[model samples]
Each structure stands twice: as C-alpha cells, then as structure tokens.
Target: MLSPRESATRERVSLDGLWRFALDPEGRGRSERWWTDELPGDVEVPVPASFNAVLPGRESHDHIGDVWYQRVVRVPRGWDGERIVLRLDAATHRAVVWVSDTQVAEHEGGYTPFEADISEQVRAGEPVRVTVVVNTELHWDSIPPGFVQELEDGRLLQQYFQDFFNYAGLNRSVWLYVTPRTHVDDVTVATTGIDGDTGTIDYRVAVAGDGGHPVRVVVRDAGGAEVARADGAEGTVRIEGVQPWRPGAGYLYTLEVAVLGADGEVVDVYPQPFGVRTVAVDGTRFLINGEPFYFTGFGKHEDFPVHGRGFDPAAMVHDFHLLRWIGANSFRTSHYPYDEAFLDYADRHGVVVMDETAAVGLNLDTGAGVLNQAGPMETYSDSTIDARTQETHRQAIRELIARDKNHPCVVLWSIANEPDTVSPAARPYFEPLVAETRRLDPTRPVAFANFLKATPDLDVISDLFDVLLLNRYYGWYVQTGDLVAAERLLEGELREWAERGKPIVMTEYGADTQPGLHSMLREPWSEEFQIDLLAMYHRVFDRIDAVVGEHIWNFADFATRAGISRVDGNKKGIFTRDRRPKSSAQALRQRWHGTEEPQPDTTRNVQQDPQQDLQGDVPQGVQQPARQA
Candidate 1:
C-alpha cells in the first residue's frame, strides 16, 4: 500500500488514458497465448473506466469472462536502479498482470489497490507492454457475491446477490511508481488518547527491503507547524494543545514516516493525514473522544450513469456538496469500499464514515441478496456461510482495516451490509470476522448491518459488535406505505436494541421517490411519502437516546439489475442519481441543518405542508394542489 499521492522520495507516473481492449468471453485468450502480446480485435477504451458501460451493445455491457486490457508504458529514465512497481488501482473481482513475456502479479480483491514489482522486467527509457486479464464472473466465494443464470433460451443473465450493477473493468487509475530499494512499506497510526492539553498518537512503520533501518516519524498540525517528533518504528508522540477533530471542524495532522539508508540519506517517505480523536463504546452511548456522538447521513453507493461505478472526481465532489446541503454529516460505504480520495475528502470535510467491506448479501438463495429484501427469507442455509466464503470475507476485512485504519473519518468498521444475520448459521460465520476485526484494530467500533427478522432464538449474533446497526424498513417495505405503524414497529425494535445496552444506529431507512413524480394523497413512490416516512423514523430516533445515528437507505439512486421491484434501479435515494434534491432533502435540511431542534408532531399521521412552513424553501418539483377546479 502507498500514499494516495506521490512525492519526490516516492515518485509515480500515471498510466490513465485510452488502452487497447479485447473481450475474451470464449476464455481462449489464455490458450491462444495472448499474454505475450496484444489480442486480435483492436478496440481502444478509456482507462479508469469500466468497459461495460462505455461500449456499444448489450454483449459488452454484460460480458462476464476474461477481458483483456493492453497498454504500453515507458520506464522513466529517472527511475533507474530504483524499485519500480506497477499498480492497478482497481480491477473487478480478479486480475492477472503480465509485463511482456513475464507474468508479474495477480490480485484477487477488486476494491483495493494492488501492485507488482517490475524492477528487473523493463529497461530504463524503454517501452514495455503490460497486459491485464480481469475476470468479472462471480461465485459462492466472491464478496457481494452473485451467480449467472443460464436461461432456457441459451441466453445468460448476470444476477448479483447485491443490488448494484455489475460494473467491471480497470475502473480505477493505474500507476507506475518508483521508490528506493529499502522503502517505507507500511504505516499504521492509531490515536491513543487525548488529555486536557496533550494528545497521544501511537504509530508504527514497516520498511520493505531492509530491516534495522532507522525510521523517523514527524507530525505537522493543520497549520503546517511541527508539533511532535519521534524515532523507532513503534512509539508514541505526544502533542501539546492538540485540537480534536470533530464534525464540521475537521482538524487533520499530517504524519510523515521516513526511512534512512546506510548512507544516512532519506530513502522513502510516506505521508498520512490523521485526526486526533478516540472512539469507544460505554454503556449505551457511542462516544467520540469521550462524548456521546451521533451519526446522521446516508448509506451511499459509488454508482452513476456513463461511468458505471468508475471513479469520477467531479461527480464525487457534487455528491459531497449535496450531502452537505442536505444536512448530512456521515455515510456508510454500503456493500463495498470506495476509492481512496473519497475518504480523504471525508476526512477533510468532517463526514464520519462507517467503513464497510464488500461482503454484502453473502446469504445465498435467500432474498437477502436484495437490499431491504422484500419477502419472508427466514431460512438461512449453511451454504451462505461456508468456509471458503468466510475465508475470503476475512481477507477482505483485513485489507480494508489495513487500508483505512489511519482515517479519522472512519469511526466504525462495518463488516457487512444486510447479511443473513437472523439465521442460526450466521453466528459462527460473523463471530470470527467481528472478533478478528476487534483483534486487528481496537481503536474503532465494529458492527454489521443487521436485517430485521428471525426470532430471538434464530438471530443470536448481535453480541459480537461494539454497537448495533439495525436496517429496518417499517414504512417502506414492512407496511408498504404506512408511516404510522412503521413508527410503532420502529420504536419497539429500537427498544429491544436499547435493552442490549449498546448504541443503536438506524443504518437503512428511506422511501423511493421518483425525481419528477409528486402526489397530494401521500402515495407510495412520492416525494411526500419519502419525507413523511423519514420524519416518522427520525421521530422515534430522537425519542430513543440509545439511537445514535440514522443513515438513510441511500444518498442517491443507483443502477441495479432489471427486476419488478426496482423501478429503473432502487429509488430510495434522497437525491436523484444525478445529484438533484428530492423532497426529503428539504425536509432533512429543516430537521438537521437549519436548527438544533425541529418541532413536529411525531404522533401525527399526516405531515405538515412544506409549501407554507418550510422557510420559503420548497422541495424540488413540488406542486401546490389545485384549488377546487
């Protein structure tokens, strides 16, 4: 793993542009020996994007086999004698890389960055051919797992157990970086504690090529003033008068880890920005730096049109702006880990993130495959929690923790989203994963998104977490449009969770609101209904002090497989897929952003009209009812 950016000591060249692409659906590319050179059909496609959504034809959009990408990169002359590495930011599912005739690297996970050492493979100032084979197919062992259904007509359909489109490609950037022989391999920084005027930071560094190399660590405050310095790989640095990072006041300290070679020259440097804050679970409260903290945001997806889950900075910026506009302060990367720069922005902007793994919908055959599954899916088969999938999930979590442990924005580590938690088999599957996370990093709280179901006897895995994340859909999916009963059921469940003596966060709660659709009768799929339902859930959330946060089901509408239940994808987003505000945004602004407290009748069935009372701010596309026509 490397820093998100490059410096003089650790230099990198971006290989993010058009690349030669070829589809190998027949899986003959390996047998035909396409690894040595380019494949036959010559089609140039953009790097940092999924070939699925950019190309024409339904075949390319749903191609689910070995896809090849070829690009020629020139080794920089300045990188001579240095440890040259080729890094793929992200490739879906699995990827194998070959530098010309030499097979360099193979990585299994898709959401994290992986690199291959190519120091001896290429000559300085010469061009080298790089080939990447990405497998987009899914199986029982895959996280956010899915299966392909062979129809009776010989037509294959990709059906994901998860609710998002299966966007596959080198959907993130590629880079060729150069570092000294003995580099700063790994950096782990943990916030120990914060007393009145001093804050403690515990940090460690792993040098790559050589051991016993002198390591130096330095920390600079937000104003670029050096506050503390320390030596040794594992030691603590105490900064006097340290400022704690809080919501809307994201104070970050830059920690630089540097290694020195035998010549006493700086070989490599890794800079990481961290916040000085501690998170702990006490009694029934989730505390951030020793005070009760509440999380109010959305369970978001890195999805949109054209790019199809590809990393788009402009879109991400717009989404963050809209989130701030809607009075949201946090979000959970539901189902998968997002790009690195996303968390960097979250750290800068003070948005707390429940950093979740890509291990979603692991419960096979059951409708739990779908988010907020819309049926009776009580029977949790053993196949869902098999040994192979468990091991894969464990690896994903380790990589996630190792990658994101430094971010102050990440206050909670969510192991999975909407998994089969109610089954008897889930206990053995989830217990070890949560235990391992706590073992790996005890700084943050560990929790998983739990679906509302199963009896107390069947659902027995709630004790493993530092907090409780309940994904209940009382108004939207339970009663199908009734917020009143949804309120009662939501309250009762919150009561049960409060009895556990742990903080409860409503991780998933929202209604589907079509962007242009509006209704006066408060019907389903209307913006008003979305606002009404959220208001009800927020009422119960405010009443119960044990409830610490409420992350709405989604921040924006995202692409999903074509199904009867999903209307052009799940419409539960408070904002449209294009980042336009729904009525819920205006309502949430009043409830969260405008005032410290919003006064409303939580027990009332009908909500107040936004046209008159919402401080002259009307919901997007809301229409005033006609006067007696």
Candidate 2:
C-alpha cells in the first residue's frame, strides 16, 4: 500500500484484498480441489496485519507448524500486455509463493520485503489464483539457528521465542505490479553532506532495461521545480547545492528516476522521498548538522499486542504517535532491526533511530552471577565470548547497515544488545568487528551496551566504540542498599569516567512495571517509584556533563521470558506492554525535552486514592498483593 497523504506514480492493481487459504501444499497447484473459505470467513486476514491474531482459537494460542493462504483475482484485460508481478511486503521466516499452482518465488526472513514475478504465471482475463505457504517452525539448518523447547506434554517445539511474539504468515502488503520489461529495479539517493546553504546528494540508480537505454534523473524540491537533472546510463549521479532536508521542520525532497525507451516514452518511473541531513558521531557526541543533540528515546520492539511482528502500517503509525506524544526524539531498534517501512516513517516524521543489529541475549551464561566466567578467578575479557556467535553477529550487522544506511533518521549503528564478553578473546572479536563497521560506513557512531563496574575490559573496549553506552539497572539488579546510595555511587562512577574525557551515553535505565500493579509508590518497584527514579535522572543529566545523551530502557512494556516474581517478567516500561500510558508517563511528558512546565500533581492523588477494587476477584486464597511495577 502507498501513502494515503500522497498519490503513487503507478496506479497499482489493488492486490491487497480478501484472499483464500488452502491447507494442502500439494493442492496449491490444483485450481478447484483446494478448500475455499466463504466470503468474509476466517481465511481472509488483513494484509500487513498479524494473521496469528485472527486465526480460529487464536486467543493466547501457542504452537503451529504450517499454513496456506490463497487469493483469487480477475485480471484486467488492459493489463494483458504488461508484465504482472506479486509483491509481499513481508512474510514469516520462510514462505513459498505459487500463482495458480505455479511456484514463482520463495523468501526468507519475517522482516524484509520480497517479490514474485507472476507476469508469465498468471493468465489474463482468467481468475488468477495466488497461494502462499508459510512455515513458522525453526529449522536448525537456517542461517540464524532457531530455538527449541519441550512442552508440558513432552512434545519438543523448535521455534524462536524472543522477547516479542513472532506473528506468522503474510502480514504485510500484497501488491500486483504491471510493469514494462524496462523498469527501474531500485533507486537510492545518498546525502553526502549539507553545508549552511547547500546540500550534496549522490544518486545511485539500479535499473533493469534494454542495455544502453538512456535514463533521466531529476531532483525536485518540495515545491516540484526541477532543481537538478542528469541523463546517463543510470549509474551514480551527484547533484550539488540542493536544499537540505532537516528534522522537526519536515523538509523533504523528491528524486525521480525515469526509464526512457528509444522513443523517449516514459516506460517506468520510481520516485523516492528523502531527507538530506548530515549525521555524525564526534567521539561520544552525536550531532546532526554539526549541532550536538541528546537522544531521548525508547527501545522499541517490533511486535504488536495481537499481531505478533506482522506489518500494520496504521499500527506502526500509532506507535509513532505515542513516541512523539511522549516527547521522545529517538528510538533504538532493540535486539533486531525492524521493518523498512518503520525506518522510512521515522525518516519523514523526525524521529532519530539507532538501527541495531539482531544479536542479543547471547554469550552471557544467564545461570552465572559474575559478568564473565571463563575461568575460576577470571573475569570478562575478549576471549570468553563464543567464536561461532561472532560470525552470526557480523552477518546480522552487515545486513542491517547495508539495508538501512540511506535512512537519515538512523544516526547510530548499535552493533549488539546486552551481549557479554565472557572470555579474553572477546576483545579481538569486537576490535576487528568495529573496525569493519568503520570501513563499511564511517559516518555513524558504533555503540553497544556496557556492563558497569564489573569488568575493566569496558575501558579497553571503549576505544573501539565511538559512544560508550551503559545500561545500569542498579535499582532492579543489585539492591545496592538504597536508591539514593545507588544513584550516588553511579553518579560518582560516571563522573570519574567522564573525567577520563570519554564520551558516554546512558543507554538503558528504568525499573520494571506491572501496569497499575504496585504495592507502594515509594518503593523502587512501584510504577510511581520508577517515575521518581527517572525524575532523579533528569537532574543527573546536568551533573554528568560529559554524558552526551540517554535513552530510557523502553518506551513501552514488552514481553520478556526471563522475568522476576510478582510480575513474571521485567515490568520496566513507563507505559504498559499493551501501549497504555501509566500515570508515570505524565510525569515524563512534563520533564521531557527539558520542558519546565509543572508536572501534574498525580503523585499525591494516586497515593491518596483508595486501592483499586481488584480485591475480592483475587483467586481463591491468593492475596492480591500489589503487583510489580
């Protein structure tokens, strides 16, 4: 689906409609033998929305192996001469595409876009049927090994259970493209640099057409006047002194790539809108347009409440609204990279992104207490991390950067999340990896989460990363005596590190929440307590002058299997996992962006109000102690 705000250049055959699903993989080819759902039955799941949320008996349902989705469409006679293509904005980990029993394409990864050229497979003026078979089970032979678990029934399930739920099937858009043989394959515009008055743009165009066909490239400002034009073999074209795109102010430019036939007839044209902002990391300082800015954002997960990780543009837009409303200026793609459209939306909507690689929760022996445990007395060093895991980390980072570098909103390249350096060899593992990132794109700063105090190896590794991000969960992890004491100790330590003149970013901080489930507002675990803790940090931000920025642990609550008692999981989010705003969220809205407005007096009122009437409903003898927040 294209943007509702703007019309698309190509009037696509609205292919995202009600479709049928057949259970049989073999019958996918046979036309009529397949099971067809009555119109408006459970078979037709909304495109870009999670199918797992709508399947029969889907409420809190668990495991599934395979499923089939079939859609029938009557081809327009006018589209007979043009090549028809089927585009799946996203599918699960693995899926095979069949149009009328003819297998056309297969795709891997539940996060990226894939296309199947069904031009030759579909018959014009006939009811064309497209079938998609999806497998959500994790196969060990795949690139990133999936997880396996034994259920209570003694049945083993092989699948990945990350922090968020994995919504299976085709969740993104299904578009049909009627294109001429000579069409634009891809068009990427790189904003090299932007000075005070002028912006520099480098256009890298990839096209598929008759060899030697001339292509015309045009750059237009938001007003639609052609500012720069280039005609060539559709290679790299550089345009200088163009207006630059800035954040918050919503400045955007349009780059049009037109494929011209011998007769100069416009065969196919692709227009991409981009912002040309200069992003840089100076030591530990993050800058856009040469101005230093603090990153106030959340660590966002890809999963939605019901859809799992499926694509819902509207749902994503709603997420963005919450982010903006909360006055967050940035977001970290925690644990894994998100859908491309999410990043694209961030670009235009003025939200900074820490485009992270999908490497998290590895190397650390969760069973151990120490930071790194390679030897009896040994601590974390470079060597303790797994050798096999290093390659997987590199591959995920490479793919993430290669795909997301063009986004202006992406300022930091988060190499990994909460990964441990269990051995001494781990230093060498990271040294070369960070160096390679610089080699790939030295434009953005490289950063990862740092374990505090436990390991001196952090200082050794700090040189490799541009920004040293620390995730301190002092209030939750180690009781550390008292909140004030812990905050003081952390502040002193941070000051000592800042005295080293190293750049620092507090990557994560916040207590868990049970969403309206707290015993005392004064205790650190309470929602009110978490709010007060963050409020204290607002003051610390000024004290730790060297700290360039900080992103709260998360914007909203997310699912985590490794949770603690009372809540069953970490309830650290300021908002509920379901995206409901907590009373503490209001406290943030006031102090966010350094606003001086007086925060609403919710603390006194909430504390004074009688405990909510969730009492008698408590299970048989289970005392409803205030949950964990």
Candidate 3:
C-alpha cells in the first residue's frame, strides 16, 4: 500500500546482493519455464535472507515448495520514459514476478511491500531476466493459515501456524525504483484535530496521472522551517505550538507532498513523515494527545539470531535500545506486520505501535494444544476455506490500515491473533473483521489478541474491542505456578475486562525462561519463574483501573520450532535469543525503569531449595506445582 519510496529526486536500483536461488520442490518452476531463461541449478541466494537460516545444509534451508529466484537487471540507461518499479522488499507466502518470460506480478500478502511496473519488460540496453516465483505455502485461504505435512521419505513438513519460526526466504529488501511517469501515487497522513494550541494535519495525496498537476502539501518542522502550507489534493495543516508525539518524548513532522507543474516546477515530491499526534479512547482511558497513555512494551517478534525473520538493522536499533532500557512504552506487532524499519524506529524513537495482522492461525478446529481447555471447544471454520479465510482477513485489514495509517508510532489496529473468539464460528469470522476494521482506518484503536479462550462465561468477543487485548496466561498458561491461582484467575479476568468499558491491554503475559534457568523455590522454567510471572502480571496491572497495559510475552527470545515445548525458541524472551539479559531482564529493570530490584538470593531457600516443579514449563496435562511461593 504505497510504501516503496525513493523519489527524493528519484532513480533507485539496489537489488540488494546475490540471487539465483532454487527449490521448486517438484513444482518445477512453473512447469519447466523457469522464467524463460537461466537458473538451471541455482545457487547464490541472499537478497534479504531466511533462505532457510542463511544456508548450511538441507539443500539450502529446508525445501518447501515453489521457489527459484534468478535476477540480472540492467535497464538503467535513461530508464526509457520513466516508471520502473519492481520493489519487492519481502516475498513470503506467495509471489510471481517474471520479466523475461513476461508474467509481470502476482503477489499475495507476504508481510507487505510489493510492486512490479517494470515498464513493458525492460531491455533499454540489455540483461533483464528477473524471475522471482516464491510461494512459501499456507492454506485454508491463508493469512497466516498454515500446516503442510507429508513425510514417509518424501519430506515436506511445516506444521503449526503461528508462534513464529516459519522463516521463508527473500525476507526483505529488493529495489529498482525510479518513478516519474506522472507519479506521486499515495500519501495519507492524519492527526486531524488537537486543539488548545492548534494541531490538525489531515492531508492526502494520490496523483498517478490524470490531468497533470495541483498537489502541494508541505508542512516541515523538525527545524527545516516551512511551518504550514497547503494547496489542494486534500486540506488541513494547522500547526501552532503543537509538538506532541510524546511517549518517551519524541517529535517529528515533515511532510512535503508536492506535484506542482504548469511551470510551478517540483513535479513529483512525496516526502511523508508525519506525527502531529492524537490516539484517543476515553471511556477507560488510553488517550495520547489527550494524555492517559500507559502500555509498557512487548508482544513483538520479527525474531532473530540468524536473521530468521530477516531485516536486522543492527537488530532494529537493539530493540529500540531495549525498549528504552526497559522503561518500556508500547509494542505489539505480535502475530505479524513488522519491518518498515520497525515502523521507522517507531517513528523516530518514541515507541507505542500495536499494528498487527498476519491474522495468525485463525483457529480452524484447533489442533494439538490449540487453546485446549482440554479441547472440544475449538471452532472458527465455517467452510469454503472459511469463506476464503475471511477474504484474506479483509485483505490483511486493509493492508494493516493502509500500511499503518501514517505512523505517530501507530497506536493500535491489531485485527486477529489468538482468534476463534469463542465460536459461533467466531461471529461470522469476527463480524466482518470488525466491519472491515471500521471500514479501514477509523483512525486508530481496533484491537484483538485475546486468548486464554476468551472467558468471562465464554467470551462475547470482548465487546468488540477499542482496546482489551488480553492474552492472559495466569502464572503462566493457566495457574501453572499458581500465584494464588494466578491471582484468582486474574481477578475474574480483570473484572470481566473491567466490565467492558474498554482499555485493558495485557497482551500476553510471559513465563518461559531457560537462559541459565534456576530455582530455589521459584520454579516453572525459573529465571525465578520468569521473575514471578512479571511480578504477578504487574500486581494485576496495578489493581485494575481498567487495567490499562502490560505487553510482556516477549521482548527478546525468538526462533520457535524444535518442539518439546520449545527449548531453542520461544523461551518467552525477556531478552536471551542472543539479546542476552533474562533474569526477567532484571525484573523489568525493576518494574519498568525505576531500576534496582534484584536481591532475593540470600543463599536461596525461600521454602526449601528444591526447584519447585512444573519441569518443562507446564501446559499440556498441566501438573507441576509442589506449592512453594
């Protein structure tokens, strides 16, 4: 959705290194055409990784189905009347591209960015080739829906849909760019309305040919002057004393849309980088520009330790410098949608995101331990591929609210993660995915991610979210360590989600520590039972108050898929997975940035030093509770 930039005086071309990979697993590269040339025994491989964890065996990263990359390019001469494209920054569950054999484009949701234009199959001076052909395979109408098995000496494995580690190849980065054939295309921006000291913003552009020019938006502020300026293409700019983009205190504003012409010059700009601010929610508080914002970090995972989910910009600025050294602010890409340089470093280092959507494993009659309140409850799948998986989950929630409704650290949009909202077939698949996400971007707040079988007398879909992202696990997966029965089942599920008045975000509570696991009394995969399950889910999110926020289910520790309840992965990561830390990251830097907490080890024995129980991190015939704490 309009996010393949490079027009600051256009002209791109950085097809990011190696190519010519292979695989096809007998799909035989479009039945032996292989994009009409080259790629016979393919090899090189590396444009943005995951080629099965940067190769080292298994025919270069466990062969799935349909693969084959290629590459050759050339064109550049004078681009021959403009408009090139080919972008591709990711190519997971499906792609098609081809240039020499002509195909054009075929994409089908693979984490985002996709383009093709290629101006009538290139050849301005030679080489061309291209070819792509991905296809990591997913099913029941895919949107994260997966499960491909097949063994018996034939090998094909992939089981399990969500919880990370599927890492297919061509994970990101691949350009060619060069626009201007009557360019501009799209550029939303929203903030609209701030008051007290003036704010607004609004703007919207989308030029691509059709009667020449007249766009012009421009707003600049982080010191490059320009203040406010508008000419058409869509109004409102406002400005005044408005700096607001605060979380850890951060600000940014510098639009510059343009299109001008008719002798006004600047024929195609499109700079976009907004952040005027406004995240509203009101009822049970979660405002932003209106204040009340509380959402301490993690539900994350684009995962790493070998570029599994690829795109590591120095591990994305060290996970936003360890979520501002554990004081946290917000995070929740969990279940999908990440990388656009991690929302441009949460729009210049402020934080707060949410933005989900790989609509995770949409239930489908649950399998294995799938939300087993002892199974037989699993629902969601009304057939016809669940109506083509709810139309690819409403086109991945309108492409994650059109590629993250103009950032300001994307407040919230979620969609589905931990779905099967306690079936009646999940209210016709989440009532049209919450009416196609409030008809795509009703400006922030649209939540989802509520597992723990959405209780409260068997869920009513958390009264259709505006916020109530509960992914509860009570002392870890249902009273596993039994902190007084996980605080009376989280005070009866936070008083039934604070009596449904909204705002409740405890999106996934943690408990999976293995980094130097220890236990004198604190058991379950101890790093002291993941620091006593985040100080008992932060003392029940500080005694309700509509339980505002918590996050913690992962800030680090990723790479899941060696089973036996994940040992080499999904160690609920409060760091470790190479990001280190994990003594519950020093008890969340002492319950979020107040620091100095780690003490209790005065030679062990809080109740007879014996490694309490729940040996392999309970959850599945759940037992282990020698009762200690």
What's each prediction's clash count? 0, 26, 0
lDDT of the structure predicted as candidate 2: 0.63
Task: For candidate 1, give the lDDT of residue 389.
Answer: 80
Clashes of 1: 0
| lDDT by residue for model 1 (61-110), tens | 87978899999889999888989999988899899999998899988777
Candidate with the greatest TM-score versus the true structure: 1
User: What 10-residue stretch in candidate 1 is worst by lDDT?
Assistant: 618-627
Please provide, for model 3 over 1-629, each residue's C-alpha lDDT reduced to its tens digit, 9 standing for 90 to 100. Answer: 66666656577777877888877777867877878888887478677877888777776466677888888878778777777888786688788888887888887877887787878778556778788888887766778876566767977776554666778767888888777788788888888778987898777888887575888877888887888898888888899987877776558987888787888988778678878888889998888787777777788787676668878688878777767766676788888787787887778767778888888767644543542122232345443237787888788788777777888888888888877676666776687788778876777778888778767678766676688887888877776887888888887778876887878878888888888869899889879888877887677677777777778888888886666777677788888877878777766755555536545677777578444311111111011112222
TM-score of each: 0.91, 0.80, 0.37
Candidate 1 global CA lDDT score: 0.81
> Global CA lDDT of candidate 3, please?
0.75
For model 3, state the Cα shift of residue 49 in Å.
24
- Give me the runs in candidate 1 sitting further than 4 Å from their true place: 365-384, 454-457, 596-629
Question: In angstroms, how far off is 107's CA in candidate 3?
Answer: 11
What is the per-residue lDDT of model 2 for residues 1-629, given as tens digits with 9 covering 90 to 100? 22211123354665675566534323332344232332223555655555665555633134455566777787767667666777776676578777775678886655555676677877667887677777665433322334455668986544432344445677667777666676776666667776666677667666675776677888777789887778863444444565554445446777777887789988777777777777766654567777766766677776666665666677788787777666667788876678788878877766778887755544334313332122232223333334544665565566566677767778788886654554455577688789878877777778887654434334456656777777776656655326776677677667766765556777888777667656653675567777777766656666766676667877777644333332443466777767788777777665553445444465566656544311111111011111122
Residue 197, model 3, lDDT = 79
